[model samples]
Target: MKLLSFRVKKSHLLLVGILLVAANLRAPFTSLAPLLDAIRLDFSLSAVQAGLIQTLPLLAFALFSPLAGSIAVKYGIERVIFAALLLIAAGIGYRSYGGLFGVYGGTVLIGLGIAMGNVLLPSLLKRDFPQRVASMTGLYALIMGVGAALGSAAVVPLSQLSALGWNGALFAMLLFPLLAMAIWFPQLSHGAARLAIAGEPQQRSGSVWRAALAWQVTLFLGLNSLIYYVVVAWLPSILRYQGFSAEQAGSLHGVLQLATAVPGLFTGHLLARMKDQRAIAVTVSLLAAAGLLGLLALPAFATLWVVLFGIGAGSTIILGLAFIGLRSGTPAQAAALSGMAQCVGYLLAVGGPPGVGLLYDATHSWHGPLLICAALALVMALVGYLAGRDRCLTPAEPLNEGRLSEEER
Candidate 1:
């Protein structure tokens, strides 16, 4: 009875720790945008250079993601996550005082930390909540979205506090990881025992690499991420040009981020209920396209379009994540697919924002860049359709499980 009770307690503790870890994943990435202009001015950076700064983390995520699986396999997910959080805290704290080199160095560290966390979390969710993978993934995404919104919303206020300054704003991020570390420490102590139960031996599956559905899912994920990050990095600037105050522009950006959380909360439930997620994906992509067009054609109504874009983008994000689990034949496949998707997709995505900024700088107008994004959205829709068909990523599975099964065969 005592042992059973202890097991229950450990499970509860583990859940809480996972939630906290999820909450910390996105804050560091999104929080810096609100302060970008201020930092740019202080450092005398051009728009392109500033955009590159914002692009660094995405680049890090892309570059480091492929290695995350190998690292997690050897070190254990919990240890890597905990260590990553500490690195994030250190990076955030260090950047508070550094010069340009220090800032970039620290940002790279933060990005690497986030990359490890991002690649591992879904696998962790799969391991911990295998029966409720979709639901737990939705919750995880929701918390991450909330964390991002909070980080973006808090930067200005944090910087304004009497003694805080910009450094204070950056340092504020350290608190979340520190708290998460405290909560996660106990789990690390039992890491070896858990590994033993789960088996420490690594088994590589050959099917994941040969799958066509895997590439489709990865492309869809990448395209969606490109669109999302482009907006996150530049939407405020776009709004600023539309004659809104800096604060209002930042608020709009924050609203878009906040809206992402809503779909995340419901996506798992929706995926579980409906096998064919293609129609939903197509509709959401159209909404995202409309929102972007709305911003371009009707800048005066930025708020409405931003909201539309947010909902559309947010929903698509949830759907893309759902594919990570739904399309994979097993948990290990899911993790492998996730690692492949994020690595390749994010590397593709890393170009979106900086590319947009460079185009904007050269063309001296937002129209060209906006149009390019719209085209990308169309591609996202097409790929999403191909990916959304109800079939496992393994080639042996036919399309008939959910939708277009007969046609696919």
Candidate 2:
């Protein structure tokens, strides 16, 4: 009984550590946007060039995510996660000191770090909390929202500290990863015993790609991410163009990020109780659509539109994660499904910000880009409905031995 209790205590501590690490993944990336104008002025970059800087990490996410699964397979998730955090620290430190090349290189590293965590966290959650996937996903999303909000909110103030400068602002982000590392180091000490064994019995085949249900989940997550990051990269600038001060715009962006936590905390409960997740998905997407439309029609009301957008976008994010767990039969299956979804989904997602910027550059107006995103959100709604159904990926069966023997003979 004492040994069993000790095991339980250890498991709880590991879960806490994993979540802490997950929470730090996005803070560094998101925090930089609020201070982009200051950096651009200091560096003298064009709007398109600045957009490229903002887009680099996400592009890394698209490129690096597939590698995460293979890495986790070989190195153990806990070790990879710790290594990713250290890489993030190094990336941020480098960017804080280096010139333009350093900035871009550091950004790429941060993206790589985040991509590893993004791929591993869902799998870790599935492995650790099989029965509570939805709830745990909700918690993950909630903490992510908190991290994003804190990072976004702090950048302006941190940048103001004369001793720290913009470099200080970037370096300030190292604290979270450092804290998470301190918590995670003990799990690493446990060695292979703490790791999920490769080729375990639970790692069975499920025809995820062939399943329509799997596609739906992937599409929904992809679209949600595309829309979410587009806003993250551009919303402050968008609001500023619409007559708000840079400070006000940044604050509003932070608020929108904080609001993300609300739906994340509740969406899982709503989905678990309700038979249909489609309605919630559609509702959230439409809410986002409405916010975008409002921004187009009433740019002066940026704050109000952002609130609606946040609610819509946040709810969809929570629901998309819930579907990952709901659609898979086992933890390994969920991990495989998540890996497949994020791999394809982020590849599709990487296009959003740059594509929007290209359209803006071509048209010389936000109207065209806004319209395109709105339409995408509507399509996301339709796809989300199809994906959120209560179904799992079905595996193929082997042919009969008698028929195979006759053919071979």
Candidate 3:
């Protein structure tokens, strides 16, 4: 009984820690999207060049995510996450306070920091909260969504309505990540990420890279990322093009991000109870499609459309992250799968903002790019079906290998 109590207390502590880490993930990036035009005007950059600011992080994610697992193995998950948060804090300050070089370089550093956390968080959950992966993932998404909502909603007002200009607004936005960094500091003593010897030997990194399930989850996550980051980068501009005020546009972007948080509260309940995730996964994509289609067809209902997209984007994100845990047999495989998926997933997303920018440059229209995203949402429906399977990484390994539940084995 005493041991069980201690384990429960530790679980709660880890839950708090993981959620705190999740909050810093997207807020930093979304906070800047509303300010992209301001930065562009200040820097004298073209649309394509300005778009690179958004692309740089995704590029960093693709390049650095694969390395996070190995780094964690060497240094420990807690230590690596601490360092990642430091990079995030430092990057936020530098980007906000410095000039053009600081802008690009700081964003890159922030990306690298975030990439480590992103890859490790699911693996951490898989290792620690083996019984409730889906539920915990939902909570993770919920907190992350709230943080992003605050960033998107507040930054424009801070920059426009307060004493803080764009730089000050961004600089001030560093507080959340700084606090998260501080919170993570104590976790260093937990030791580095290590592999467990499950019933069957854990599949190596190459097995994960070669697995069809991993690839499916990768595409599911990648396409969803493509949809999300594109909207994050261009939604403000898209709203402006549709004749909304800058403040209105920024507020709606916040609304969209806030809407994203709503599904996180329930996604866990659904994923936990449902036999498979195909239904929710497919519905989520269609919701995004309908929302984007509404954007093209009906500009007057922008709020509703944004909400739909947000919910879809948010639920799919939760599912994708859940898949990383759900599909892997061991935490090590989880990290390997996460690294590979995010690397390619982000690579698939890295081109979106710039491609949309160039498309807009060519046609002076947001319609084309939005339509393309809507079509991809359909593709996500199919990918969701495959990724939502009830299988594990090792076909014969019981789903309870980490927890070692005999019934499951």
TM-score to native of every candidate shown: 0.88, 0.87, 0.87
Which residue runs does candidate 3 get wrong by more than 4 Å? 1-6, 41-46, 156-165, 192-203, 236-251, 363-367, 395-409
Q: Best by lDDT, which number?
A: 3
User: Residue-wise lDDT of candidate 1 within 1-409, one digit each (tens)?
Assistant: 9999999999999888888888888898778877888788889999868877777888898898877766776666778889889889888877777877767878888989988887777767666776666677777788888887778778889998879877789889887789889999998876565553222333442345556777788888888898988887789888887788999997887688777788887777777777777888888888888899999999898888988888888888777777877786554556676778888878878877778888988988888877888888888899889888877755344232223445566
Candidate 3: tens digits of C-alpha lDDT, residues 96-173:
988999999999988998899899999888877888999999998898888887887788889985567899999887
Clashing pairs in 3: 76-192
Least well predicted 10-residue stretch by lDDT in candidate 3:
192-201
User: TM-score of the candidate numbered 2?
Assistant: 0.87
Which prediction has the highest TM-score against the true structure?
1
- Regions of candidate 2 where Cα sits further than 4 Å from its true position: 189-191, 194-207, 236-251, 274-276, 297-302, 395-409
What lDDT would candidate 3 get against the real structure? 0.84
Clashing pairs in 2: none
Global lDDT of each candidate:
0.78, 0.78, 0.84
Stretches off by above 4 angstroms in model 1 are: 1-5, 41-49, 194-209, 240-248, 395-408
Pairs of residues at least 3 apart in sequence or in different chains that clash in candidate 1: 399-405, 400-405
